[model samples]
Target: MEAPGGPGAPPMWGPGRKMGFGAALGSRSKGWYTVADGNLSEVFFPFLDHVALHELRFFVSAAGAPPVDDSGDGQHSISWISPGVPAFRVETTHHEYRLTKDFFSDPEENAVLIAATFTPELPDLRLYMQASAHWEPGTDGNFGSVIDTHPPALLLQQQDIWICVVGPFSRANVGYFRSSDVHIDLTDADGHLTYTYDRAGPGNVSAGAEIGIRAGAFQLAIGFAHSRADAEEVARTALQKGAGAVRQAFERAWRAQPEIPPALGKVSGDDGMLARASFAFLHCLEDKSHAGAFIAAPAAPWGETNHDGNHVYHLVWPRDLCRIATALLDAGDSDAALRAFRHLQSQQRTDGGWHQNWTLDGTPHWQSTELDQIALPILLAWRLGVAGCLDHDPYPIMVRPAAQFIIREGPLTTLDRWEDAGGLSPSTLAACIAALIVAAEFAHDAGEHVAANHLRAVADYWNDRVEAWCSLPSGQYIRLGSDPDRRPTEGSTAPEFLELVRYGLRRPKDDRVLRSLQGVDTSLKVSLPAGPSWRRYAGDTYGEQSRLAGTDRRAGPALLFDGTSCGRAGANT
Candidate 1:
């Protein structure tokens, strides 16, 4: 039976389904678009953290066969059009026809342009464009309509957000989702648009139009604006400019980035290309309005069957920011790295703490606090200070408050980096200890001798207790701080113990560290044909289940529920 309308929830957020994303560099463009399954997936506007458009899908049908949804039912593959830019060429080979979509964002305005071409145009080949506009972060009450325009267009709105799609179409329809929409008609046995409407609103709705394919090709533009007129103009301008020209601008904009640093210029071939790609992707993740803010990802994890809107992945995390900042610093973009530090300063809580994660506007989400998150900023500041990148002192604004917070809540944390159980996690403790030492140095440089001495003492105390609190009787480090006598096997191993060496608290050759390494390898590591990989830990049940499994395993103590008898498939994350 056909489910009608469209997908009930947003598409998957993992890169597998979300694929690659592209946006114009700098602030000229305010929209970011993602490609997946040979079609446009989520389109974020104004901010990287907020998802405005659910998906813009293309469909094709012949005289007597069911219409093939380009993103829904065909075998599709994606490759980068430009080596380091987000521009992508997604090709889908269907049983009846082949389609190619070249995706890129407009560098001059807020729009997503796609140059679509279908080969072997079948007899009575009918092309359709479907727009599923969530408007906000999730799919809820939305209004869609067919606007009166030259080439015909569609407008969707939710609250203050408005999105308009413009292209060349002969016929169009808008209706409520599921019960009476174009999707229902497209999925019917005949694969035709039998039912149609002028507008649908105040509930889940969808809009579709019959695209006029000229020479087996069509161009599309999706634009964001505050009003319908503005959106129309945005989309019209991009379409008028043509996809090829806009794409050229997109490539030129990215290629115009600052010259590669010595660290990046040293490598060549695929490795060098991969490094440049990393920097380009990192650039795409940052918020346009907020200089230093970058979302963790442009997708929602487990979005396939998980329709719960509350569970999201596109948000800011201080822990993630630390890595991003450090990467930028290593890539020799000190300006970007410093901007990230300043952004952190603004997001820091009045008590010198940070929430688990947050939106770009510093709106906190998630309840737990990981000490490493509180400490990593100080570590980054120290790194920047050491590299002489600290144009203005961070001592009073950032370093002082963060160091004080760690002093008030060190060693013991409410949760680990995984947001699971909280205790004296060696990784968290390592960061805290390392942060305190650096904070003391910053304080000493700032001439606050008393504060500097106190921070150093705290660092010393935490460093001394590293082994006592984390080590088990076997000299292996336990995953968390607890009574070693009653510790279970599942609690005996974790990959986070390596932070001891990472933060310089212990030598790589240390006997205790070596023993913990072996324990982790024996318990959590999985040797695959490609290479050796490690799960979060043993007895962990926080991932997709295997196709062969019936139910998930019983979750560990820190986790809520493990499956009863299910096998698990390893995630590539």
Candidate 2:
């Protein structure tokens, strides 16, 4: 049930796509991103700046044997074709090269160091430099000024930030080379500094400063800052401590993470690897410095092959966050669960419901015109309470208002989880009912009997109408309280039925529950690659057109219910 798709429009591309080693480091402030491959892929502080400078991967060429590809597609071709090692080391029979990149975060700034070890048979280690401000799909973000200062330092500006590439390498062709031309041909240079811009090429236009090493082993420290002073300072420090030390520190942080508790069971073999990777994915998607908000995925690939396609997922949906919270609590990481819950608490709308989605910074993004969003936070808060992760007084200011909104709007025509506005979705009703019952329990725990009774009554009222609200006139269960037709059934509603049972609103043998399961299993239960995944509803447009059909790109053939149905699946007899 491992669904590996996000950030990269294709399963084959994007920083997050091939990530498995969990060796990547992110800034606490989330101002920077550096993968183990030595590419400073993301720098989004003052502005969103992304570039790939690995084109100059310390390749060695004979005196006249032509420098490595100055073409912009070199890195892309390498990433797409060469493949990245899970750990971080590259080798060949003649040239055995070991490269390790690690980034460490500090209150002052985040710095990255790349340590390389290679054989000395080759002459000078040619350096390559191509940088750009934009992604790979459009106009190549041109190269900026390459200012070389005394004591061996070069400041290159791309997009908004100043990148300082400073090291004590024995030699550099462009140890100090400045180019006013936005499009300098790479082949003309001696592998010192080349900022090649190929707008017509299949990959992005970027420029990087390549370093040539006569000695087999050397360290390069790359530092990023909005201003030149900061970049130089950090770059100087990085040049001093080297990449090895940063990698060691980063490894320490990775090890510091509490072990996954045994309660998660014997998560081993293929499933174990998948589970570990999924957990790593969640950690990879989050920004540790800024309130620990999680992005849907890294924002690198959109500007690459996906074009602007990957912008939508870099968000923190409360619904999605709830899934993360559940995982954390189950893993015995109550502290993480609490932080996520508090983050959710921060997003509750003034009206007691929540926005459909939000940025990791807590800014509201796209939302639905439905009740489920409101139901999600309440459900999380209640669960946190059960997990003993709730920090404050039970059922704070947001809880009661949310419960009341469900009481008032639970049965009304609204948006379903899929963002369609019309009828109440069975999932929406079930979520609302769960929220109310839990709210009542929390209120009772707090000795607020009156509030508890009122919430219980609302739960009961909604429990009775849950079927009626989601039923079609044809006597078949509709995807929502109101649906145009019942032909394409919903698999989502099956587990919502179980939520009703868990909330004590229905019996496991309830006829409606059985019928809802039967309806979806009969129609919507198409076999996905992993297993049987239900369409959100019939005629679902998601992954509707296959790439093989030469139509719109489809992200799926994936099941919508990996984490979606776990709790509800518990009610299955």
Candidate 3:
């Protein structure tokens, strides 16, 4: 899809086309706006609407600034700098800047990437941008929801610029610095030479030179500066050698990325939708070695609150990582798939639960609030083994402790009695069972009789529990016994249950597996007046609704199950 704004849109400017002294503004949707000053020296994008499921919007703007002095003179500093935009309200005293719109509609979403930039009229002007994402609370009014509210505040003061991305209970911050001490000099046939120096380190640096040229419909230039020399000399040299080389290198890098054929149109129909969904899921997987696959909406920003301590929609979790990783491996991103497992291994807690949140600093808060710990990691490990990322023997070593934790601790017992301590609910127990089944298969492959027997024993225990629960009506499952407010009617429908049934029944047909799937199929199926067996809800139904609403609300839409069985075509398993 085309970006929300056309070329050269203005900052803080609303939709429509308008001409000004040297500026024009336009927008493709309410979520985005752009502006271009007629001078052609700079452009600004003050609002970026990323489709993050969080309740936040990002506002960013950029402009050119005139060069003053680099002679260490305080006279060059100006406190009243302005980009000539009215929509941005700057509070100097509080050092806070905000947009004039209600960016969050629900308590669980916030606006992110509200930023502004100042460029210079010089060919290589230094770029200065201030960007930030906001955070809010979740819709559920539990204390655990509060943990998802505020954006993590990193302790770093100023040695490095803060790069903050909001996750479930915190923000991920990476510090970057530009390397100094690198200098270059270029000369042409005319004896004109331009000398440039590198100013590394995070804060802000100026690119003082721009090679005057264009390549492939883009303005091309070498971004550099004179080495404390005459401006005219540097400009002449940059125009001749530096600019050309930089432009070529950048073009090559841009073209190096994997390409999508132009024939790939908007994906429609079932097959196309599945392909597109799988592609998107793969694209979101972080290529970093230790990082788990993150399900971040492309370009989505963090959410913010309205100073009332009310929460909005900026959140993330490692559990989602496990889910997305399973999808990624299914989609053929084996490296990323393995990375997710490795991340789980690195972040597992001593209590046998995985940390729900993976912050930038690697600190696991171990919020004993929810109980996906034993379940998600174990399942991921099993999938990794099947995918050949783990060996059979190692599989049992990793799976046994987690399973033992669940059984010995009474999977249904709460870790935090006040707020549903990280313990097994039906959904979690089902996930644990599924992982053990996978482990058992791996053990059988490795000829480890002891491991296989132990796994079978554990699986039997889970099977008995599921069988007892199945004795209930079609929809009921065992709830965590320790939850005081637990109701027979309250239930969760994560793909976890479907995964358990599918994995458990992979061998010779088990009646229990068939019964469970039948129950799930019955409860999840929906029929329209026109047809039956043609539709069903996937695991992401709620997540998709949350994305559309721009908030974290559970009462959005119901999933439907048509003819497609849970494991065969539907997404849960």
Candidate 4:
């Protein structure tokens, strides 16, 4: 696309590239941008220092205009809306900067260059600059500026690049500009400039520029920053001395990366429906990890606000942490998988349950109920086994106390219901019992018979209750102590039944239970290798699914029997 300017516009101000920033760097800086074949282009430039304050601008032709909307708070921003394509935009008021590339281009054969100029509208301050080749995210989850040795930082010289201080600006600021496999230089012709660059392997060379001067009209160049008669000569020297060898080395390193299949998973249909869904789930999984102890859905808490009108899902909850840890473990990030376990152990309540939700500071704000909290240790212990990380036999200490609390409080009795605050549901009691049973097994493995006995008693209480509440008409278990005056709705039973099935609790074989399970299976299935089937009974839908009536199907839902009941089919047997 053509750069934004009138016909025959004299090369606007700086550089010889007629395409301007629009062609080279794209108009916007936020989303994604490309230089080579669109497929080999994955570039991101996130400004750190002014991320929160400054606005990012992208100059796109009509063909590339992003979906525009006012960020509910009234700020103007464009949403890329399109999936997969690398789009660009800017962010204002950031503190640190970051760039990510997925080997879309060849560093040696192709060059990716970026340049920035600082012109102070007000003059009285000098821009202090520090730039590095690459920085990884800090332990605190923010990006850190640490120079890595494997990819060396590019050298900088001021002969060709003008590094003049236009004015003594009030604020001393730092800015960065980086390019891969390219020569970089800063000169003090019109103003001071700073440059950062890295090279992977030998091939084509590229250059980038970054300058921090009092916000004003300043001029900076890529190869030559100065306007001297010998500026080209100086620029060539800078390129040869500062960039050539580095570019060659970077090219070699870039090529060394094993070319495995792209991380993109399977796609279904012409529209790539499955691929889109997978991308969304994976993106959410990655971004959610950024929440520290929890995973926030990509839609955040905003899209699915809780009953309290707050964004509960925006913060990490116990359930999400468990799912995220499992996903991480599955993805081969064992270390990160363990972080959630440790976080859960650290947050355990004195009574052995975890709070429902917490803010980023780890402050518990919502209800500190039994169900949510109980799931924490249970999930942690389960993951320990799944991830092969529980060599120390930490399950008893991690899980027994919670189980004991449930046993002491009376199993199948609502200990605490966050949603109703005062009322208890049979399903809640069942879930608590199910968790305690798992905990009891862990206790038994640890030879903690006393804890095991207590858990066993809790399980007995729940089983007796389940037997009494079993409804032949529904073929599913009814919630104990549910008000007879209230009508049972699909929402009440589906989730509860699904949870019981998923967690390995025995359900009566009455037609109603069969019908209920079939109903759930039909509603939640997405296409997969085996067949369309119900999604797992996550807590959100557990309560509802549990109440449905059973139906006979020639083929039953895919049943994943927990170790305890892998062979058992009937409660009597």
Best by TM-score: 1
For model 3, the run of ten residues with the poorest summed lDDT: 102-111
Candidate 1 TM-score over all chains jointly: 0.89
- Which residue runs of candidate 4 sit more than 4 Å off their true CA positions? 1-292, 298-312, 370-372, 408-430, 467-493, 507-510, 517-573
Q: Any idea what lDDT model 1 has?
A: 0.76
Model 4, C-alpha of 194: deviation from truth (Å) = 32
Better of 2 and 3 by TM-score: 2
Q: In terms of lDDT, which candidate is strongest?
A: 1
* Candidate 1 segments exceeding 4 Å error: 1-16, 121-124, 135-140, 148-150, 265-271, 483-492, 527-530, 547-573
Instruction: Give the alpha-carbon lDDT of every model.
Output: 0.76, 0.50, 0.33, 0.35
TM-score per prediction, in order, is: 0.89, 0.67, 0.44, 0.44
Q: Give the per-residue Cα lDDT of candidate 1 at 10.
A: 34
> How many Å off is the CA of 475 in candidate 4?
4.0
lDDT of 2 by residue, 27-111 (tens): 4433434342233344344212223232223333334444442221122211211111122332322232233332333323444
For candidate 3, write residues 1-573 as lDDT tens digits: 111111110111111111111111112111211111111111111112111111111111122322121111111111111122111111211012211211000001111111222222333322111111111122111000011124321111111111122221112221111111001111111211122222212222112122122111111111111121222222224333432343333234323433332234344343343354344434423422225534322221111112222111112355666777776676566666676676666666665655545442345433443444566677787677667876334454556566556556544535421132343444555565666666667678778778778877877776566534422344433223234333243343322344445455332255544554565566555565654441122332221212332231111121222222232223332
Greater TM-score among 1 and 2 belongs to: 1
